[model samples]
Target: MDEHYEKETFLLRIQAINKTFLENHQRAINIIAAMVAIIGFHVYAGFAIAHDFHKALPLFVLMLMTYAGLLYFLLVKQWLKKLEPILQLTADVFSRIWNFTLFDISICKVISVIIILAAFLVWIIIDSANSRIRLRSVGGMAMFLFFAFICSANPSKIKWRPVICAVLLQFIVGVIVLRWPAGNEAFRWFSEQVVTFLNYAMIGTAQTYGFASSPPEICGFSAVFIFSSLQIIIYFGAVVGVLYYLGIIEAILSRIAWLMQYTVGTTAAESLNAAACIFLGQTEAAILIEPALKTMTESEIHAVMAAGFACIAGSLFSAYIAFGACPTYLLSATVMSASVSLAMSKLLYPEIQESRQKDIGSFKFATSKFSVIVSIH
Candidate 1:
C-alpha cells in the first residue's frame, strides 16, 4: 500500500509539472509571436515611409516603447511573478536527476536582463541615428534566426535567452574590436609578439631541418617553413598542459564559464567547453570537460559540437598567418566565433530538457605520466 501510494503521488506530481510547463510554454509562444508582429510592422512602416523613417524615428520609438510597457505591465510582469515559484519547483526536480544545478529566476536576474536589453536598444537607436543600420544586415539576421528556428529540435520549446545574449555580445565585441583604436593597437601588439615568437622557433627549426631555401643557392624572402612554423602548436600544447596541471586553466575557464552561464544560460561544463573551444581544438576542449561528457544531455552535447564547428583554435592561427591571412583579423575572428558558435548552437538545438552535467570546480588532466606524455606529444 505504501509503494502504491508513492507511485500514485509521483505520477500526480509529474502530471502537474507537465501541465504547468505547457501553460508557460504557450504564454512564451504568444509573447514571441507578439514581438515578431511588432518588429514586422516596424519594418513595414520603415519601408512604406521611405525618407520619413528618419523624421518619424522618435515617434516610432515612443510608440514601440509604449507597446512594450503595456506588454510588460499587462501580461509579462504578472506571468513572471507567478513563474518564479514554478521555475523553482522545476529546478528542485531537475537537480535531483541532473548533475548540475539550475538557476531560479530572481529579481536581480530580471533587472540584469532588462539592463542588457536597454543597452542594446540604446545602441540600435544611436546607430540608426548615425545611419549605420543597414536593411540588408537586418534581413540576413532575420534569415539566420529563421533557419535556426526551423532546425531546432523542439521549436516550441526553443529558448531565446542564450541565443539573444550570445548574438548581442558578438555584435558588441565586434564593434569594440573594429571601431576602437585601443583594441586595434592591442591586436597589433599581440600579432607582433606572435611573429617574434615564431621567429625564435625558427632557430630550432633551422638546426633540425636547415634554413628554408629555393633551388640552388637562392634564398627565399620568407623564412617560414610550413612544418617548422606549424610545430609551434606542439610547444603551445605543452605549455597548456602545464597550465592545466597548475589549475590556471581551470581557474580561467571557471571565471569565463561563470559569465557564460548567466549570459548563455548553460551549465558550467557546456560554458567551459565553449570558452575553451576559443583557444583549443574541438577534441581538446572536450577533454577539458571529459568527466561530464558521458553524462551530459543531448542538448549539451549539441552545444559542445556546435561550438567546435563554429570556432577555430589558436593553434592554427600561425598556419593561417603563413597562408597570407592577416594575424589580427584571424585573432579577432577566433574570438568573435566563440559567441557565434554559442548563438548558432542554441539556435540549431535549443535546450528543452534540463542538462544532466554537473558543475565541476576544477579539472586536472596532466597529473599522470601518460597524460603528460599525451599532452606533450
Candidate 2:
C-alpha cells in the first residue's frame, strides 16, 4: 500500500508539470496568432488603399487609432498580463542569437572578419554606384575612424560587436532614406505633415499677439521662433505628462531601452537615457534615469551624455522646421546619430567596472508627485 501511494503521488506531479507546460505553450501560440492577425490586416489594408492618398489617409488614421487602442488596453488596462513576458522572451531569443560567439578557432575568426569586410565593400560599391563618391563622404568616414582610434579608453579591451552593429544599423537607415524612393517619399510626406501641424501654433500666436496679417519677422522668417517654441513646449509637456500618467510612455520607453540594451550591450541606465533623448531634451532624458545616476559607471554616464548631445528633442523639431530646415534630413540625422553616439561613447569610455544595473527593466523611472496638469506646469 505504501509503494502504491508513492507511485500515485509521483504520477500526479508529472501530470501537473505537463499541464503547466501545455498551458504556457498555448498562451504563446495565442499571442503569436494575435500579432499575425494584426499585421496581416495592416498589410492587406495598406495594399488595398495605397494607390490613393486621399482615400488612404482616413484608413491610415484609423489603423493608427486601432493600434493605439490596443496598446492602451494592453498597457493601461493591464489586459493580457503576460504580454510583457512574451515580449521579453522574444527579445531575449534575438539578443542571444545576435550576441552569440563561435568557438575561439582562428579559422572561424578569419572567416567572420572576411565576411564583414566583404559586406562593407559591397555596401560601398553600391553607394558609389548610386551617388558620386564625394570628398565629403570619404572625409566623413576617415574622421569617424580617426575619432574611434584616438578616443578609445581601453584599446585592447574594446568590444567591437556593439560598435559594428551600430554602424551597420546607421548605414541601413541611410540607405533606406536616400536610396529607396518609397522611403524617401514617406519621410518627405511625414515631414510636410509635421510642418503643417506645427504651423497651427503660429496661427494661435498670431491671434494672441496680434501678428495675424503681418507678423514680426526674425532673420527674414515669418514665424517667430520664441512664440512657436513656447507653444510647442507647453503642448508637448502636457501631452507627455498625460501619457506618462497613463504608463504609455514608460511602457514604450522600457521596450526601446530593452532593445538597445540587449542589442548594443549598454547598461540599463545608458539605454533608457538614450531612448529618452530621442524625444526629450538632454536634461529631461537624464532625469528619466535619475535614480540610477549615482550608481552608474563612468562609461554609462558618458553614453547618456553623448546620446543627449546627439539626438534632437521632439520639441525642437518645430524650431528647425521654422528655420526652413528639411525635416526629413533632420529626422534621419537624429535617428542615425543616436546609434552612432552610443558606439562612439563605448569606444571613448570603455566600461572597466561591472555595471550595477545590467537588466533593462531593473531601474525605476522617475515618478511625478503632482497630478498630470501640475506636472506639465
- Taken over the whole model, the C-alpha lDDT of each candidate is 0.73, 0.78
Q: How does each model score on TM-score?
A: 0.62, 0.71
Q: In candidate 1, what are the lDDT values of residues 175-289, reduced to their tens digit?
A: 7778789988777666766666555555666666675521234464564456465666765676677777666777677778778777767777778888898878788898887
Count backbone clashes in candidate 1: 0
Show model 2 residue runs off by greater than 4 Å: 1-59, 68-114, 130-132, 135-139, 212-225, 372-377
lDDT of 1: 0.73
Q: Which candidate's lDDT is highest? A: 2
lDDT for model 2, on a 0 to 1 scale? 0.78
Worst 10 contiguous positions by lDDT, candidate 2: 368-377
lDDT (Cα, tens digit) per residue for candidate 2, span 1-377: 99999999999999999999888799888898999998898888878687786757756876887789788887875855658888789989976665566674455445676798698777777667756655467579768867886878888777776676677667777877888999888777777676666666667766776663346676775645465577876667666777777778888888888987777777788888888887776887887788899988988888989999999887788888767888999878887887778888888878888889999766798886666445422
lDDT, candidate 1, residue 374?
49
